[model samples]
Target chain A: MRIGFIGFGEVGYEMSKGFLTEDPQAQFFVYDPLYEKEETQQRAKKTHATLFSDPQSVAKETLDVLFVAVPAPFAEDAWRSIWSELNEETLHVDLTTASAQVKQRLGEDMLNEKRTFIDGAIMGALKVYQHKVPIMVSGTGSTSLIDWGKSTHMNLTYAGDLPGDATNIKFIRSIFTKGLSALLHEVMQAADKLALDDIILDSITRTMDKEPFEQIINRLISSNVIHSQRREKEMENVIDFLNSHGIEPQMTKATRDKLKMITQANILEKNQGDPPKDWKQVMRLVNCT
Target chain B: MRIGFIGFGEVGYEMSKGFLTEDPQAQFFVYDPLYEKEETQQRAKKTHATLFSDPQSVAKETLDVLFVAVPAPFAEDAWRSIWSELNEETLHVDLTTASAQVKQRLGEDMLNEKRTFIDGAIMGALKVYQHKVPIMVSGTGSTSLIDWGKSTHMNLTYAGDLPGDATNIKFIRSIFTKGLSALLHEVMQAADKLALDDIILDSITRTMDKEPFEQIINRLISSNVIHSQRREKEMENVIDFLNSHGIEPQMTKATRDKLKMITQANILEKNQGDPPKDWKQVMRLVNCT
Candidate 1:
């Protein structure tokens, strides 16, 4: 079966390989805008699948299933450009962290073309993609299409007749789980500043005792991961949207303020290259732990 | 040994009962302006402890250890008005959740007089007080005093040769763990509104297989407990106080905003009742397994 995978990002590439990992005999074709990056190029070398130059080329490949491994809201403008290029025979399944509203638009298009559209979301990270993480798929008229997920070595859990059930779950959970990681970064630091770092930890531990406190603290606590720092602003954007919707942002606001104070406050003072006061203190705090 | 307890509120009364639970021979006495509630009254009835009418009566009894379980800041001022009535031999242990500033003042006062002062923070609910959950204590002249914790059944973990060490840990952990519970509330609801709750639960279960998700989510998720409907206002107060110290309020703003809209826009307006939403629905949003 020819499978056309779009958007070879981190999750995208992992899933593409996941499909192959489940069934070696399956023919795979992939396309990503950033596929020329050194990492993507190296990934392509190992996968040994058809790498298309553009979306149209992947679309032209007489694919049985068109897997959209793109990012959240994968494409703006209602995915019109990508939709217009797809063959009517191919089925489309989105594995991105997308919203139901965006999926509704694409759902209308898929229904019009009489093609199967599966609302899908990956429940686990890349390394453990298909092994234990059953990819949850749901939507109108998807009972027949999920067989592809099952056949391709993916444990497909049929999520009932909702147009965007799985992705909806992924986004909401991410808002908190990832949001907690962000929350930990902000709260721990704030408490640490008050010279109540241990007290802060105890207050959280409460009646529950499980993981080594340090591991949970470090993962949730800030370790100065420059890459993760951007999440503060992104969380702010989410909180702002929640605020616009008249809902409280909770940890998202705390997260944003912390990020803003650390990242942006320095820009105003012209302090460059020096780590955030928080970044430095977190290290010292953890050492004391 | 004559052990004295001030403030026969739930925590103090429970801790005193816990003392009796393990060591029935340990004499217990309680003193509070207000009478103990039903739970405490029942405990005191069963334990057969003497109830003193005022703090002076307990102090005049010349107790080996005086466990002050009263509320803080307010209690700080409360103690000030009545402190001159107490005996100098009393080793004061404040298990109340007082601020660092209050502990510092009290610690300094006791230090100058050569009286032992132990600052402690109670962890877990009263149920776990003597059974398992630890009560952390911080103070140098604490060992001889805390030996009664063993004879009279208190699970005490001492920090260092300082008055603030134990309280510091409790406060630091509180910032993240309790903050997590608050953060979970907002995100869980976000999932609930979106109707992607199951996926949210599955994602966390799959992603964080080792962590204790159930207890954490139960404490934070709104469905289980009625998160203060006025949570936004209360959280803002929590954040503002923390922020006044140059330490940020971690989940303060976001937690407030995340729920204010939903509670105000959805639950408060559409549904009416305590814990108006089902707890499972809320936990499903936190996606903690």
Candidate 2:
């Protein structure tokens, strides 16, 4: 089997390591602007991959499979630069953290050229999963890619048939992962102010002992109407306290805004006679408003 | 032992049930506007607590300990309504989810009036823990209150001498819990649009197989310099995608704002030569900028 990689940055490097570790007999080719850099050169030599000076040369190598592991900002440009070199036989796959729109455009362009394009997005840290990361793939060629990936012990999921479904799933998933990080960052700042960092962390981790998702959903629905007014006021106070401590409570501020919107919409008052029975019902009330 | 409850709402009622279950011999008095409601009356009867028409009457019972479990907005009013009724022998502990400023004011007022006031904040769902919920307490009287709670098998922590320290911690913790709910709501709505709700949820819960806090912090720091630019752009796309789908991405919007702030401050560029070694280092760089 022959393979080519574009962009030997952190993700690209880790991916190469995983690929070589898993399939040592597979031939490899590489093309990155930093190919001449000492670290890049050493990595290429260590992996025993044939390195090419330009993307055109890597594309012209006529590899059966290609992984475009460029940075998100440079992904579209990179694909365009190597567009002419790829033919119908090359199964071109993207591994950039790009938007659905960008992925859809590239996928459509490739399909127009009678080439296989699989929109792929990694859902975990490259350092942790390397090439075996959970990759959400979409497009007509996704099934074949998933089959190929599974054979090599690479974790891949065929998201849907649409060009951008996989990327969309990934961006939406970011709402959970990145949002959690931002929340923790804000909380840690406050914990530091009180010199209660360790205790606060311990308290939070302990809460994780329970099913937080169920607890959260139950509390949200059961107390949605009973406490919205007071909760909103407390959130306003949170904004003040965070500001006083020189921290921008972006998430807290948004929470306050949302709470205010809820009260203004008067959904609770309207549903007072017949309150929501569950979290889903509560969401329906919210949406109706 | 004599005890009085200043409210008969959801939290107040659950607490009464738990306390009575643990100490059946303890005398109880209650006061709330809803005390006349069927549910409140039924709960008080079941718990064998004496119902009072007003906070003043409940205070006049000369209780050994009193719990203020009113809503956050009405907490101050409830305290003031019974201020003249409380005496030196009464240990008044608050369980409302109020702002630190409000808790501090009431605590100071109680101290000046020769009554013990412990600023306490419940750290879990009241429905789950009831009177035994993990309560973080702070103030001059917190130690004694914690000891009293411990005697009854209640989970209590003495935070510090200051009146508002415990409340501060609770408000800070809210950022994580409420922030998480907001993120989940946003993601669920997007998933619903694509009819991929189950798969998206499965993916997120799987990611939780790892230590989320450590994973989040590590990813945030390691990719701080390399992916910030791409991430910020992707977030912008997330905003547009969410809007196009008619879902207000409150958490997603806040995340974008935060990422923009990080990039705008250019902290990564300054620390390029010596990148942040950990989450704390990353935060220090953020604070420095």
- Top DockQ: which candidate number? 2
- Per-residue lDDT for B1-289 in model 1, tens only? 6777787677766666666667678787877667545666665677677886677777668688787877764657655645765656777888777765577678788777677788886755675555345777877467865676665556777666577667656644544443444344334334344445455555554555455644443334443124435445445544543344243444445545554543543432233443535334432223221
- Tens digit of lDDT per residue, candidate 2, span A62-82? 786788888778989999998
Chain A, candidate 1, TM-score of: 0.58
Model 2 — TM-score against the truth?
Answer: 0.77
Scored against the true structure, residue A118 in model 2 reaches a CA lDDT of: 88
Which is the leading candidate under lDDT?
A: 2
Candidate 2 — what's its lDDT?
0.77
DockQ, candidate 1, comes to 0.16
Model 2: DockQ score: 0.40
lDDT of 1 by residue, A156-271 (tens): 77776666766556545544554454344344334434445454445455434556433443343332234235546345444443444333345555645555544543322233
Candidate 1 Cα outliers beyond 4 Å, as residue runs: A6-57, A69-89, A95-98, A122-136, A140-158, A190-289, B6-57, B74-90, B126-134, B211-289
Clashes of each: 34, 0
Lowest lDDT 10-residue stretch of candidate 2 chain B = B209-218
Candidate 1 residue A282 C-alpha distance from true site, Å? 37
Q: Return the TM-score for each candidate structure.
A: 0.60, 0.77
Query: What do the candidate models score in CA lDDT, each in turn?
Result: 0.58, 0.77
